[model samples]
Target: MEKQPSSRLGPLEKLRSFKMEKQKSFRLPGSTSFKEKKYKESPGKRGDMMLHLAARAGNLPHVQMLLAEAGEEGAKDLVSKQNLDGETALYIAAEKGHVEVVREILMVSDLQSASTKANSTFDAFHIAAKQGHLNVLKELLNLFPALAITTNSVNATALDTAATQGHVDIVNLLLETDASLARIARNNGKTTLHSAARMGHVEVVKALLNKDPSIGLRTDKKGQTALHMAVKGQNTGMVLELLRPDVSVINIGDNKGNRPLHVATRKANINMVRTLLSVEGIEVNAVNKAGETALAISEKSGSEEISAVLRVAGAVIEQQQPSPHPPNPAKHLKQTVSDIKHDVQSQLKHTRQTEMRVQKIKKRLEKLHIGGLNNAINSNTVVAVLIATVAFAAIFTVPGQFVEQPTPGYTLGQAFVAQNAAFIVFLLFDSLALFISLAVVVVQTSLIVVEQRAKKRMVFVMNKMMWLACLFISVSFISLTYVVVGKDDWWLAWCTMAIGAVIMLTTLGSMCYCIIMHRIEEKSLRNVRRSSTSQSRSTMSISMPSDSELLNSEYKKIYAL
Candidate 1:
């Protein structure tokens, strides 16, 4: 009887029951609705958040599970989703050295996109490099070899980051992957060597140099090389390492023209100064942009020991004159010549009565003049030979090397850079230097002029040729720099040219000034001599007593006595 029935409810009864159920599910005026609550607790969003957490915890299993649950499209979204710190699951895993987790996430996600997307500052490869996660780096590089060159937010590549952090193995690996990374600089223009040397990473510096020694020659925005950076630290070993490969960098100047020795002196590092000075070819007296030498800087810093070291190493403080104007060598030379002329004229006028004295004076002047000409000839001969030798060597060892095998556009034994404009200019200038120097050598050796005037004329000709040869050698060196430094560093070559131009132009200007001034003085002296002779002739009777007349008057007085 009780079961008869659970009979179906009528339409009004069903409506009443549905209304009761809806009210029970409904929210108050300020309460959250069912749809809003369901959205707030979405599984996919929670799973993504967990994925980041699990990856950071290095839980490879949990990461895989979360990624699988998100499926293909959803897994990509989850893997790329960044937290408040802009860190993705892959970035965190890589940073934490979770190699398996990195590998797992990379397997499912697009590596190019994931690696390219930086988290806050650095991406996975850079972070792993900075963290010294060698295995993680290997995983990233193995999957995407291009990641080795990918730059972080700071415009630093993985190699730069690793070298800065002193990760030797990581640095070596990255270099092996792409040796050009050693040349890649940061936003600050600091290469991997600069960073390693600055950070006092001796081993890392060694590794970098082993890959490419020329990288040691690279300068930063401040015109500082690896040696310049090395001297700033307390590690003398680092300095030695840099010097071992290229001792030429020992004298390389920074923007302020401060070499390593100068910098060490400024820092009051006596040991460093001693070590640098002990190096062969160290320019102890090298002046800086401010005209301060290492000794000068040490004196200014009040470091007695460093100053003593510098002085002992032949470092002399350049004596700067108090004069506000630059020195004029031409004016000095003219004054010297005029004084010599006046002295000689006065001596001759006073000694004219003594024929033997006049002969002696003439012989003395001739001897001195001949000696000067001999010295000039000797110096010119040495310089000419040196220039000729250097030019000969340069022609044989052409920049960019000669072609070993004949190519479609090349012939055997031809220069690889024969067609390059820079190489051609180098060859032309080098040949000119060689031939000009040879000519000078021939003139000095084959010709022998016994007369003083003839010898002076020959010396002058040789001197001019030597100057021209010197200029050609400088131009040749500058032009060859363009071929050596490559196109990317054309500015470096230009800088070398600018510096060489300044020096050469200054020297040539001074030489030209002296020559012009000497000519003008000689012309004026000749005119003065002509005018004096004319006046003596025109006023011979009205003028004061001549030397003969004075001597005769003295003889008459003596006879009266």
Candidate 2:
């Protein structure tokens, strides 16, 4: 009597008819299972009430029963589906600390398949980690090993989330797996080490460093290391953790070459500064790229506590002044030529053996026409091409300032005067600075070449160079002022003088700062060398294996592992 199920209603009609027939013959939740409906409906449509229910009722039997009868296809639709906001059931389960539901949802292999993914589509591991659900995390990692590498939509892996949350145990577990701490970066170029140090998670920091001591010195985009972050975070425990022998705190700096000590000075933490100085070879007076030493930083930062620490550490606090210089052209030129010849000869001799070996290889390969040799030649050619390309791009992209701009101010008369003045000044100061820099470079090179021959104290040479830079920059500043004053505009003249004054001060300050820093560094290095010497002498009585044992014992132990 029923119009044969219309062909247009194909699959839908068939499903409905089947359900209706089954309802009469079977006691399914077809149309009359309010209780069952409440339980059987996927967690998405039910809101918080259902989430609570799922947490309470989503046991092995309950889920299995729902899966078996509800045609699971309907349930699969709810895997990642959201009820209100953009959160899926998996997210809800993970966030609510529902371990069983999280596991149940994760177990559905269908979720991993291409078609019906978890409604959240997020790796459940990240959610569990962020929520500090350690057990749930373990289960997820145990079941889905690939989840260790899987990142959420924001490109944060489970390990990253855990580190960010300061969940030490969770981070340790994630670290135990092959989830490389090095490979994980937040949206920033920051690593798990960065997060741990910033959060003052001392145990986590120690655990991370024990895994890879190199990470202790690894830098973020801002060029800050774990030590710098710890100082900035004002975590004394973390700072101590990072000051171990293995930490190598001096290895990194910010964009300005400001080290952890510099940051500590900025933070005005006397205790942190003391802790940092307690390291075996800390450089208290190390100058940054900006030429600001820790003491200078403290003074400039207006932090009295930091200044006191620096003073006690014997950091020099003085405004830099221009140094005196002598002008001698021919003698300096002769020395320079001699030094250049020596260096060139040394470089040539050192490269000679390698060059001869390469030539022999080339000759043999040419005679045989071997494929492997051809590949080597091709690789070398490719490398050469890349190098050439880079060189050309760099050359072409150089700033226009270097090439020259035709300033409207430079008339023929003015040009003539300026050129003559510049030439005269250059002859005086340029030659001197060049000679000094060249001399230092030669000495440093010669010392390296001759294997520390004569060992003329390096501090003396650095100090000499610093003085030369100051003198030369002072001369340059004076010349710049003269040139600027010669221009027509009175305001421009004053501006020029002001700029020269600033440049002169900055350059002189940097030079003196570098000199003082080199002296401090020399002293520190000497102290370390002396301590090592003394220790070696004290331990000299011990036999070979005993010395080895002592050295081995020096390594610090990490506890949070």
Question: Residue 10 CA error for candidate 2 (Å)?
Answer: 39
Best by TM-score: 1
Model 1 stretches with alpha carbons more than 4 Å out: 1-48, 319-561
Q: 1-561 in candidate 2: lDDT tens per residue? A: 355556557879789999988867877445655675675554544453343355445455555555455456755655544544445556666666777776776655343531222345454566678889988777767776667777665566777777767888987898888747446776667777888788877877777878777777667788887777888876788877776746566545788889888888778888888888767677777777777788888888788877876788778655353436675798899989999999988877766765676566555543443333334334433433433344334323322213244556564323334345643573456446555655554444344322222222343344445455545745654554554455465567466657767876786677677556656655675686577777878886311223222222211121000
lDDT of each: 0.81, 0.62
Who wins the lDDT comparison?
Answer: 1
Write down the TM-score for model 1. 0.51
Consecutive 10-residue window with the lowest summed lDDT within model 2:
552-561
lDDT of 1 at 479: 96
